[model samples]
Each structure stands twice: as C-alpha cells, then as structure tokens.
Target chain A: MMQRPPTIKDLARALNISVSTVSRALRNATDINPETRQAVLKLAKEMEYEPNFIAQSLVKKQTHIIGVVVPSIDSNYFSEALSGMTDCAIEQNYHLMICQSNENEVLENKSIRKLLSCNIDGLLISVSLQTKSDNVIKEAQKKHVPVVMFDRIIPGADCTKVIVNEYEGALKAVEHLIKKGCKRIAHIGGPKDLSVSENRKKGYLDALAKHKIPVREELIAHCKSFEEDAIGAIRKVMNAKPRPDAIFFINDLSAITAIEYIRRKGLRIPEDIKIVGFNNDKVSNVVEPALTTVMQPGYEVGKLALGVLIDEIESKSTERQLFELRTTLVTRKSSR
Target chain B: MMQRPPTIKDLARALNISVSTVSRALRNATDINPETRQAVLKLAKEMEYEPNFIAQSLVKKQTHIIGVVVPSIDSNYFSEALSGMTDCAIEQNYHLMICQSNENEVLENKSIRKLLSCNIDGLLISVSLQTKSDNVIKEAQKKHVPVVMFDRIIPGADCTKVIVNEYEGALKAVEHLIKKGCKRIAHIGGPKDLSVSENRKKGYLDALAKHKIPVREELIAHCKSFEEDAIGAIRKVMNAKPRPDAIFFINDLSAITAIEYIRRKGLRIPEDIKIVGFNNDKVSNVVEPALTTVMQPGYEVGKLALGVLIDEIESKSTERQLFELRTTLVTRKSSR
Candidate 1:
C-alpha cells in the first residue's frame, strides 16, 4: 500500500516541535537552530516529503519554475537546447514550463502573458522569427521578471542573452567550403528579421571577401525556416546566373533541404555541388553522405540560459549579462 | 506603458454591482441573470480580464495543467508528440508541464511524484521501456487523478490508453516486403518489456507464418528501443548464416540506425537489402533514398490522449477507457 507523504504537522509532531518551527526549518530560516534544522531535514528526507510548492510560493512570492518560450520544439536545435535546459533545471530543482510561439508574434505575446499569470519566476526566450519588437521584453522587465534570449538574440535589448557565436560559426563553415576549392558559393538564409540570420549572412560575405570571391546578389535567397521553403531557396541559388558550385545554409534543416533539392535536380552531394549546413542536428549524422556542418553548443546554451536566469531570480539582481557559447565544425562527406 | 489586466473589482465598479455578483456572472453561476452574465462577459472581453490561473487554481483545486511524462523528449517521435500536445493544450487555455524519464523507471517515478506535488489536474504518459510495474498508474488512480497512456500502452492496465494499431501496422509493413519477393525477412523489435514491442514482433511472425516462410531464430533481434542497440542488433542479423533479404525495424530511430549500419557494411538500401521503419518522422523524409515507414498519427494521438484525460478529469468519471488510434503505411524508396 502507498503511504501519504509526511506533512509539516506530522514532522513537527514526530520531532516534538511546533509546526511553525518545522516550516521554518524546512525553509532554512536562520531563526531555527542549526541542530533543529538538520533534524527537520533528516526527517523530511527520510519521509521523502517535498515541500508543498503552492503554499511555499504563496509565502515566498516566487517558485523555481522558469517559462521557456520558443518558436518550435520539434526541431533538433530547439529540442537539444531544451534537453540542456531540462538537464540543468533538474540539477537545480527548478521546473521548466515550455511554450511555443509557432512563429506567431501574437501567440508569443499570449504565451508570455499566460506565463506571467502562472507566476513563472523568470523566462528564457528564443523570440519568434516574426517578432520585430522588444515591447514584450520591456514589459516583462518592468514587472521585475528577468528575461534571457538564446539562439535568436535581439539587439539593443536590455536583458541577459545567451547565443552561439553565429558570425564565427558561419565564417568557419564558409571557409571550409572555400578551402575545399569551391568558388561561386551560394547562401540560403533564415528569416531576415532575426539577428542570427543577419549575422550568418554577414559571415558568409566575410568569408567571400577574405577569399577574393565577388559576392553575387542573385546567389543569395532568404527563406522561411521550413524544409519546403528551404528547397525553394536552394532551387533559387542553383538556378542563379553563375549557378553557385557550393552552398552554406543558415541552419541544418534548411541545409538538408538544399541537399535534398540538389539531389532531386539529378545532382550529387559534394560531387556536383558541395554543401555545408549549420546546427549539426542528428539528421546531419545520417543524411546520405553525412552533412558537414557547424555544431552549435545548443545544450550548453540552454544550461547557461537557465543557470543565469535562476541566479537572477534568486538574487533579484538586475544586471544585464550576455553569455556567448562557442560552436565547432564537424566535417563529413557532404562537404568533401 | 503596459497596464495590469482588469480584475473582478474593476468590473463590479464599472457595472455598479458587487464583486461577488461580478464573479458569479463571469463564472456563469445560475444565481446570475442571463442578461447580467452576457453583459459581464462582454465587459470582461473588452477589459481582457482573463482569470489569473495561479489565483484561480488555488480556489478551484485544479491547475488546468496536464503533466506529460515521457521516456525521452529528444527523439523525433516524442518531440513531435509533445509539439502536438502543446499545440492542443494551448488552444484549450491549459499549460503543459513536461517531464522526461530518460527511459528509467526510477526517474519516471520521481517525475510523477513532482507532478503530483504540483497538483496537476491530469496526466498524459508514455511508459518507459524499463517500467516493469504499474504501481505509478495505480497510485495516481487511487488519488483520483486521471491518466492517459499513448504509443507504448501498458497491457491489462485499468486506465485510458491511446495507442496506434501496432499489430496491423507491422503486419502491413512485413506483408509489403513479402510481396516484394523477400522470403528471408528479419525483424528488429523494440524492448520486450513494452506491449507495443511485443505486438509488433508478433505481427511480424504472424505475417511470415501466413506466407509459409519458416521463421529463423537468428533472423530476429530485440533492440530495446535504442538506436545504438539497433545497430548491434542489425549487425547480428546481417552476420547470420543466411543473411536476411529484408529488415523491418520497430521504430524510426532504430530503423535509421540499421540503415546506416547497412550502408557502412557496403550494402545499398533496397538494392542489397530492403528496409522498413516505423514512425514517419522528419528523418523518414530526409534520410537518403527515404524510408518506407508506418505513419503513426502522433498529433492525433496526443490530442486524443489529452482529450480523454481532460474529459475524465472534468467529469470526475471512473470508467477505464481503451483508445487505439490507427496507423498507415507510407511507402518510400527504402522498402520499394
């Protein structure tokens, strides 16, 4: 038979102490004697009595639950980030409440408002590609709820941000293609509004400048972050005036789309047109020739994002900080 | 400047009524007149006074949150299922609290305990591969908390379960391979601990038996629901005296693993050995030559799983339900 979890009253009665003393001890209050606190802790641990979060939240005005707002959770990058965040949140005894905006700004705002209504202590957000304003973050800041941006960081936003070194990661991907003796390299970029999109595109151009290859306007196409759109973007690049010999996609999903599109066009990967994708997702490992791409520290970014938010929530500090996580290039046959 | 949402008092003052009257009208209490309820709803809509969930949950003894416990959320199938769940939950003004068991019963128990402590209104679960007992479900049932199981349903469990027709899906896949003139067929099954795994394996054996093809002992291997294990399982099947002409994997991740291993062994897909996988995840579309897969309706399963739990929770009904969603075959190059 399953037994009921011990309550504060039960603990107090067992230890010959007042209920208030048991509660205070569980909260690690300094008024309670260290010996008494240890005794309460020992008993609570023995009974596996996790404190009632609702009652505790009523008193402390906060819970160790952070709202994670994202665009989509089905993709490898976001899920890896979530895996990292879940890993870190479990370690810190914090709960993560995830919300997806589905690339809708109104839905993003609604998720934020709902999270606020649920009394989340902080937020870790990767803004929707369609979100063009920082009004929501500013509003959240006014309410003293800390916000941390990851992956798709917004500029001039007065909040903590955790992002991969996109400019550097992109440069390395393009440089790898250049070193592979591919001229007429094309680019397939993400939504033009996102900072990662602009930064990655800039890195592509930076690589071209460094290699003395003229930047071709017709060779670049901005596409939605869906596989279907990525295919269209790749087709646009493949059909360009010069028809680029290689392509660097903004993200791995888009890169995979480009690879598939090229294959459908009766071309071969790395032979007819070499390809490099970003965010080395699991599919990157299995994609027919194995996609050579930049591996963003997605899980690490998530961990640090939650870590920083938890620190701010506990300390009630308002200092803005940015943590830039690094990325690495994983070379495979796709870029050979 | 962003203002706080209007409260009941704001509506009471505007309409020249008492706070209790405003609250009753908002809740559609019978004591309130029909005209008053309509007026209150119109004003509440205008004021955007969405009942604060945190405050309301305290009084209603309901969180409007469903606790979803899964074995692994990082996998494509689980993530897709979660995405569908979140989409539906948000539409119904309910929040989702996700917990990953990491395929450990101990971890699954811990997550369940946490969800219960949070006063989750209902549960949507897909049992872990290592879960040997139904104690967790029994405990929740005793406490009057509703649970809905999906994908890997527990056998003989007194609870509402939403699952795909695993037996039929597997039978069709194997029969398709047989029609392709494959006499030597191998089956890479999931963990024996799961009911779905057993059913799929039984279906495979039943298909071969019907085809008058004697099942070979060396041609079957259990992968235990892991990609890495499936690789080894496929190797074992490939190394058998009479190498299997076609292989049917129970899950997509495992199927991809087997395909990669086959390629590594210098064999071509369908040309050297035909392959079939389950769960038509995005990888099924992107994987080279594309995989022939069983398209289990993950979104519909999620919706129905949560739908049943919500129905039971709201009605406080005690009837156990069994819901098995159907699966369809998505033929592609891998099997053809």
Candidate 2:
C-alpha cells in the first residue's frame, strides 16, 4: 500500500490541536505561540511534511508558475536566457513550465494555448521567426494573463519587452570591419519578417552610409535562420561579381559556418576576409581564428523580462514598457 | 473587464443541446451525429473556448504533466537531453514543468517537493552532483509518483535509470590515447561524490593498468565541474614532475579549458599532448584542433528514459530496471 504524506490536519489530530492552529504554527505566524510554532516545526520535520502548493494556489488564485515559450532550447543563447530566468524565478519562489516551438509558428501557438489551459499566472515568450500575427498575444490578453516578450518579439504587441540593441550592435560590428580596411563588405541577414533581422540589416546599411561606401545589392543575402540556408547565402555573397572582402553575419552560428567554408576555400581570416557576428556565443571563442562578434546580454534580458512579467501579473499593471539593453563589440582573432 | 473563456456549459445552453451531448460532440465521439459535431466545433471556435486542464486533472486524477529536474540547463548536454525528452513528452500528450537545481542539493529537493505538490503524473530527474541521499526519491515513491533517472543518476535508488556506459566510455578514451603512444597520461575528474566521477575514474585506472602503465598520483586532479577549476587542475597536472603527455578529461567543458591552457603554455596539440574528453559537446567541434571524445547519447538516453517512465506510470509497474546505452569514441584532430 502506498503511504500518503502527512497533512496539516493529520498533524493537528496527532498533537490534539485545531487545524487552524497547526496551519498558523507551521506558517510561523506571529500570532501563534512560540512553543506551539516550535512544536509544529519539529513534528512537521519528523513526519516529513511537504507543503501543498496546489491548495495554496487554489486559495490565492495564483499558481506561482510562469510559462516560457522559446524557439528552441538547444542553442546557447536560449539556454543562457533560461538559466537567468530560472535564477530569478527561484528567488521569487516561482517555478517555470518551458516549451520549445522548434522555430515553427504553429508550434508556438500550440504552446501558448497549452500553457493558458494549464492556468499559468504569466507568460514569457520569444516568438518564432514565422509568427505572422498578434492574435495569440491578444488571446492571452483577453484571458487577463500578463506576458513579457524577450529577444524576438511581435512588432506591434502591447506588452513589456526586454531586448538587446540589435541596431547598435550591428553598426558596431560593421564599423569594426570597415576600420580594419576591408571594403566591399557583405551582409548575411535572417528571415525578413523578424524584427531582429530587420533592425540588424538597417544597422548594416546605415553603417555603410556613414562610411560613404556604395551599397552593393549583390553583396547582401537573407537566410531563413538555418545552417544550410546560411551556407547557400554565404556562397551566393562570395560568388558576387566583386566578391566581398569581408562579411557580417547576423548570428554566431551562421558566422561559424561561414568561417569553416572560407577555410575550406583556403582563405585566411582577417587577411583574406574579415568576419563579424552577433550573439557572441561560446562557439565564437572556441572556433579556430576565434570570431569577433557583438555580445547580446541574453541572461540579463531574461532576468529583466521575468521580473517585469511578475510585476505586471501581481500588480495587474496595464502599462506597457520597452527595455533596450546595450550590446558591445568583442574583438577576437577572426577580425584582427 | 476581463472575460472568462467559454466553457462546455455555455456551448450547451447556446446550442440547446444536453451537456453530455455537447461534450461528446466536442470530443468528436463516434456516436455523435456528424451535423452536431460540426456545429459544436464551430461554436467552440467562435466562443474561443479553452479547455481547463486543471479542472480536468482534478476529475481524472491525472495531470498529464511531467516534471523534469536537471542540474542546469546552460550546458549543451542537459539541453540536448531536454530536447529529446520534450519530443517524447509532447508525443505522449504530456507537458513538462522544468526546474534547474544549479547543482544544489537543496534546490533539487525544493523542486521535487514543488512538483509533487503540483500533482505531476511522473518525474524525470538527473540528480545534482551534491545530492548524497535518496530521501527525495523515496518521498516521491511514497506519494505513488513514478520517477525515471537519467545521465547522472543516484546509485541504489530502486527505480528505473537510463545511463551511458561511463566506465567503458572512459576506458576507450584512455586506451585511444595510450594507443597513440602517450606513455604519461593524466586525468581531470569531476566531483568525488558523483557516481559518474567514480565510474570514470575506475575506467581510467583500469585502462592504464591494462596498458602496463604506472599510476602516478600527482597526475590526477578532481575538479568541481567549472572552467576555472579545470584551469587550476590542468595547471597542477602540467606542472608535475614527468608531466603528462596526454590528458583524459571527465567532460568536454573541462577538456576545452585544458586545450586553452595548453595553448597558452605554447604546447602543440597531438605533438606534445593528446587530449580526450567525455561527452562530445558542440564546443568539442568548434575548438581549435577539435577534441576527440566519447559521445554519450544524451538525446537517446532522455527519449528512452521518458518512454520507460511513461510505460511504468501507465502500467503501475514496480519492477526496477537499469538501461545502459552505448558510448562511441569520436577521434578528431586533438588525439590524431
């Protein structure tokens, strides 16, 4: 026979006390006598009592669980963000329910619906690249669930958002390459629909304008945020009439693959063509001729997003805010 | 005003149908008339009815939610394992609530208690490095919740466990280095309390013994699974008398740090010191002179562990089983 854990009522019956007294003493309420509280604590420990969060949630109408939806957890960026979120959630006595969309919009919507059905008090989301509409966000709002968006967010959603300054980060990356005396620089961007991709591309173009460099339409390629697509995009940029002397990739994963491709073609980094990437992932440091990239504060963004979401959920605040964190250029062997 | 999502009762009253009929039609029961089913579906969609999983859990006594606890989500190994686990859980119509212990035993216990209170149907755990007792597992079992341990599992837990053949994987790693003519090989191990650390150490010793190599106490270092400690450990080993000509790191993170340390010392890889690591992390490939390591099938382990766990959960099986998955040696530039 399976043994059920001891409950407050069981403790009260065993100790010849009222259930309310047992609960108050176990909670260490000041109104309870010190002796009673101490006895309750000792008995609870002896009986191995575990707190019933579900019952507490029922009374409070708050589960203390936040649902997080991300494109994927396999990447360093997402994992690091999750780590920071976990740290903050634990500190606030909250737990997280995580779901991965695998970069599919349909999966993202399904994840949102599942989380809502599970009675999550709040949500933290990084929308998939293929997400086209804000209907899901509106649905969540209609249900009175507060949401905090991070990294990649819906363009017009009225919610709290935490993001890195992608435009400035991209501009810094390009300016660094231009300062290295590399002309005819090329750009490899991400899916056009994503705000991150669009902002980074704008930075790339504005940086070229600042340097009075001609915009070579042939030197630009947009990819669908996959390694295979990145490979094809790099090849296309390299095969241009006046092949680019340098390249700025939207992310480190793509930049790392491009580095390998360049190496296969017997091209030396910074000497043949310099490279710069976004999201200074750990791979950037480990790769041969370590990559120079923009460091996105993924961990900080996650922490701040959760903090804001909790504030909104608890306080029922309807004021929407946007937070843009800073990004910095990290120089390494690849761009030297 | 916040609007509550429409429920089955709302649909029944609006459609002038019996509540049971409405429920059956909404579920697409075979006995339900086709016209009624289509009408129910259309009304449910128009009313934006979201099923209440919490209420359903109360009635069914099954949450259809699995709780997962890991040491940390920042590492490639844990994230990949989580990916595979998520794939299986979603296929089984289960959602996962995830928590990271951050290698803290207290956090692991807290997470378990919280999950239990949430009434999760089952649990998947990789015990923290600091966990020394099985009280938490016993606690779950007493509550009639099934648990499946994977990767870094507790010894003698009387539960289902999925693990790689660590001893064999380590033995193979050391043997590969020895076969490459490395007469003096060192080891960087993990926390002493962990079963993984103990098993791998045994493998390293047996491999050296099989090769007729003398055991040198000064050449072995046990680290706390961090890059700084790994750096300190590598320095200690490298500074020893008759310094090691090869190193077998317990994991890839440690090995990657060792590679950087060796380079800083101006020693050439494979020529001066061959390196082999356990767990073929993505960083292993990105590192200069890509590392040769043992590939622990983390994804497969996660998938199989969850599969076994669901079977046990559904069947109420009491049989305890241990699954040992195969690990293969991946030779790369560092050990060539």
Candidate 3:
C-alpha cells in the first residue's frame, strides 16, 4: 500500500480544531487566531503536510494553470519567449501546459480544445500560420477563459495582444539598406494573411515611397515561412531583368536562406546585394558576414503577454488591451 | 447565466438512460447495446460534446497526460526533442505538460512535485545539471508513477533511459581531427558531474592514447555549459605554452563560441584551429565555416524515450532498459 502524504484533514484532526479553522490558519488568514494558526503551522510542518492543489482547485474553481499554444518549438524566437514565460509563470505560482500546433489550423484547433478540456485558467497563444478562424478562441472566451495572443496573433480578435512594432522595424531595416546606396530593394514577405507580414510589406512600400523609388511588383514575393520558400523567392527576385540590389526579408530564417542562395550564385553580400532581416535570431550573429536584423523583443513580449493574461484571469478584466513592444535595427556586416 | 457544455449525465437525463449506460455507450464499450451506442454517438455529435479530461481523470484515476521536465527549452537540441515527443504523444492520445527546470535542482524538485500533484500518468525527465539526488524521483515511483529519464539522466538509477552513444561519438570526432594532421588537440567538456561529459572525456583520452599521443592535462578544460564559461576556458587553453592546433568541444554552443573568440584573435578556422563539436544544431550550419559535429539524433532519442515510457506505463515493465542510439560524424568546413 502507498503511504499518502498528510492532508489538511489530518492536520485538523491532530490539532483538534475544525477543518475550516485549520485551513484558514494554514492559509494565514487574518481572522484565524494567532495561537491556533501557529499550532496549525507547527503540526503541518511536523506531519510534512503538502497542500493538494488539484483538490483545492476543484473547490475554488481556479486551477492556477495556464495553457500555451505555439506554432512550433523549434525556433529560437519561440524557445526564448517560452523561457521568459516560464520564469514569470513560476514566479506567480502558476504552472504552464504547453502545446505545439505545427503551424496547422486543424492541429491548432485541436490543441485549443485539449487545453480547454484540461480546464486551464487562461491561454497564451501565437496563432498558427494557417489559422483563419477565431471561433475556437471565442469558444474558450465563452467559458470565461481569458486568452492573450503574442507574436503571431489572430487579426481583429477581441482579446489582449502583445506584439513587436513590425511596421517600424521593417521601415528601419529598409531605411538602413537605402542609406547604404542600395536601390531596387526586393522584399521577401511572409504569408499574406498574417498581420505582421502585411504590416512589414506596408513598411517596405512606405520606405520606398519616402525615398521616391518606384515600387516594382515583380521584386516582391510572399513566402510561407520556410527556408525552401525563401530560396524559391530569392531565385525569382534574382532572375528579374534588373535584379534587386538589396533584399529586406520578413525574418532571419528567410534572410539566412537568401544569403546562402546568393553566395551559391557567386555573389558577394553587401557588394552584390545587401541583406536585412527581421528578428535578431542567434543564428544571425553566427552566419557568415553576420546578418543585419531588427531586434524583436521576443522574451519581453512573452513575459508581458503572460502578465496581461494573468491580470485578466485574476481581475476578470474584459477590456481588450494591446501591447506593442519596440524594435531596434542592429547593424551588421550583411547590410554594411 | 453561462452556458455549460452538456455532460454525460445531461445526455443520460435527456435520453432516459442511466449515467453509467450513457458513459459506456459513449465509450463504445463492447457490452453496451448497439442501438444505445448509436443513440449516444448521435446525440454527442449533435451537442458537440468534448470530454472534460480533468473531471474524467478524477473518476478514472488516469490523466492520460505525461509530465516532462527538461533543463531548459531555449536550445535547438531540447526543442527538437520536444518536437519529436509531441509528435509521438499526440499520436498516442496523450498530452504533455512541460516544465523547465532552468538547470536548478530546487526548481527541478518543485517541478516534479507540481507534476505529481497534477496526477500525471507518467514522467519523462532530463535531470538538471545540479541534480545530485534522486529522492524526488523515487518518491514518485513510490506512488507507482512510472518515470523515464533521457539525455541528461541519473547515473545509476533503476529507471529506464534513452541516450546517444556519447563515448563513441566523441572518439570519432577526436579521431577525425587527428586524421586531419592535428597533433595537439584540446577538449572543452561540459560539467564534470554529468555522465555524458565523463563518457565523452574518456573517449577523448582513449582516442589520444590510441594515436600514441601522451596525455597532457593542460589540454583539457571542464566548462559549465555556458558561452561565458566556454570563452573563459578557450582563453585559458589558447594561452598554453604550445597552443592546441584543434579543439573538440562538448557541444555546438561551446564550439560556436570558440569560433567567435578564435576569429577575434585574428585566426582563420581550419588554418589555425580546426574545430569539431557534438550535436549538429542548426546554428552549426549557419555559423561561418559551418561546424563539423557528431549528430546525436535528439528527435529520435525523444521519440524512443516516450515509446519506452509509454510501454512501461501500459505494461508495468520493471526491467531496467538503457537505450543508446548511434551517433554519426557529419563532416563540414570547420574540421576540413
């Protein structure tokens, strides 16, 4: 037979006090008599009593568990964000249940359903690339579960969000390239449906307009957030009659792929085609020529997203909030 | 009023059947009448019934959830392993609750206790770097919770484990460097207490012995698995009377850091200091002069670890099993 850990009831029985008195004393509730509270604490320590959070959650209707859904965990951005989230979650005495959607809408919906079934107190999500519906998230909200979106989020969703200033970040990246005397700048954007992609595209167009450079439709390509897709986009851009002198990519992964492909094509970076990417992934520093990138605060975004979600969960705040973290351009050899 | 999702009891009341009968029919139990099963399935489809796993766990004494404790998530190795674990777990209809220990023993213990309180059916853990005791793990097994260790495991624990062939992989890496005309090779290893580190160190020494090179104690350095530590160790090794001609690092992170430092000292890779690292992280390819590394099969390790754990959970297998997957040397420009 397994020896069960002593519970509150056992402490109450040993202390010859009411169960409620024991519970309140254990919780250090102000109303509990000081002597009784001390005695309860002493007995609890002597018996090595550990609180049963699961059973307590059943009574209080709060699990103190947050569910996190991400497109994938294999990216440095997501992993760093998760590190920040874990730190904050643990500090707040809450546990996180993490799930990966693998960038599929169906899997994303399934993950949400599973999290809901587990009765998580709240959710922090970065919607999948293929996610087109907010119905599942709305369903969670109907059950009074607060949802906070970060990084890749559902467009126009009535929920709190934490995101980097993609528009400004892209503008700065393109401006840096322009200052380096590179015209005919090509743009490799992410999925058209994604807000970050759309905003970055706008930034590229506006930067071109600011410099009075004509927008060449043929130089712009939308990719599916994969290295292969970026390679294909790069081939198309480089094959144009008047090839682009520079490329501003949606993220570091795409830019890195473009750099490799450009090198394979026997071109020297910055001299042949300058490159700038968003998201200062660690690989950016290690890659040859050291990629120039916009530093998105992934860790800060994650910590702040959890902060907002927990605030909503505990305070029951219904007013949707949006947090936009700033990004900075990190000049490196790729753009120089 | 909030609209609660319909439960099995509600279905039973609406269908004029007992709760147990409704449950059995919904589960498609063999003994349940065919007509009743059809009726339950039809109504369940109509009402969009999703099982409350938390409530179900209370009744069935099984959560169908696996608790995973890892040192950290901000690494390519761990993320890739988690990817594989997620793939296998979802296919097996199990959800994973992941906790990051941040390489702290106290936090690792806390994570285990938290997972235990959640009533997870099984545990998959990579013991933290500072973990010196297996008391918490033993406590879980005392309650009949099956535990499986992987990657960074307890040395002599009776639990099942899955790991890569670290010794052979290190030997191959060092031997390859020697074959490339490197006479003085330095080794930058991980924490001294870690089994993988000890095994890899032995491999390094054995490789040198096989090549008839006298062991020089000054050529080896033990690091704490951080970039700063690697930098410090590299500085010490490079300052020796006769600098090492090559370095075989414990992992890619250390190797990458060494590459950066060696570059800062105006030394060209493969010309001044050839390098070989373990764990072919994505950064290995992105880095300048792309790192040559031993592929440790993190994804396969994760998949196999979960498979063995699930087997133990289902079959109550007590025989201890140690699975060591093969590692292959991937030649790249770093060593060439």
Model 2 clashing residue pairs (backbone): none
The parts of candidate 3 lying over 4 Å away from their true place are: A12-21, A28-34, A178-196, A213-225, A228-247, A253-275, A333-336, B28-31, B178-196, B213-225, B228-247, B253-274, B333-336
Residue lDDT tens for model 3, A269-295: 988999998888776775667789999
Compose the digit string of candidate 3's lDDT tens values, residues B118-138.
778899999888898999999
The number of the candidate with the highest DockQ is 3
- Candidate 2 lDDT score at position B159: 91
Model 2 has an lDDT value of 0.86
After superposing candidate 1 on the true structure, give the runs of residues whose Cα lies further than 4 Å from its correct spot: A1-22, A28-50, A190-195, A217-225, A229-245, A253-273, B1-22, B29-52, B190-197, B221-225, B228-245, B253-273
- Model 2 chain B: ten consecutive residues of lowest lDDT: B281-290
| All candidates: interface RMSD | 3.4, 3.2, 3.0
Residue-by-residue lDDT tens digits, candidate 1, A38-111: 99999999876766667677567676778999999887788878988887887788888899998899999999
lDDT of 3 at B219: 86
Q: Is candidate 2 or candidate 3 better by TM-score?
A: 3
Tens-place lDDT per residue, model 2, A115-226, is 8887899999999878878899888888889989999888688888888899999998999999999889999999786688889999999999999999999999989854
Which pairs clash (backbone N, Cα, C closer than 3 Å) in model 1?
A: none
Q: What DockQ number belongs to candidate 1?
A: 0.40
Candidate 2 per-residue C-alpha lDDT over B1-336 given as tens digits, one digit per residue, 9 for 90 to 100 = 425777889899999998889888876578899999999999998887877666667567788878899999988888888888887877788888888998999989998887888888999999888887999898888889999999888878879999889899999989989989999999999978678888999999999999899999899999985444577788889998877999999887778767767877899898999999888876576455678999988788878988999999999998999999989999999998
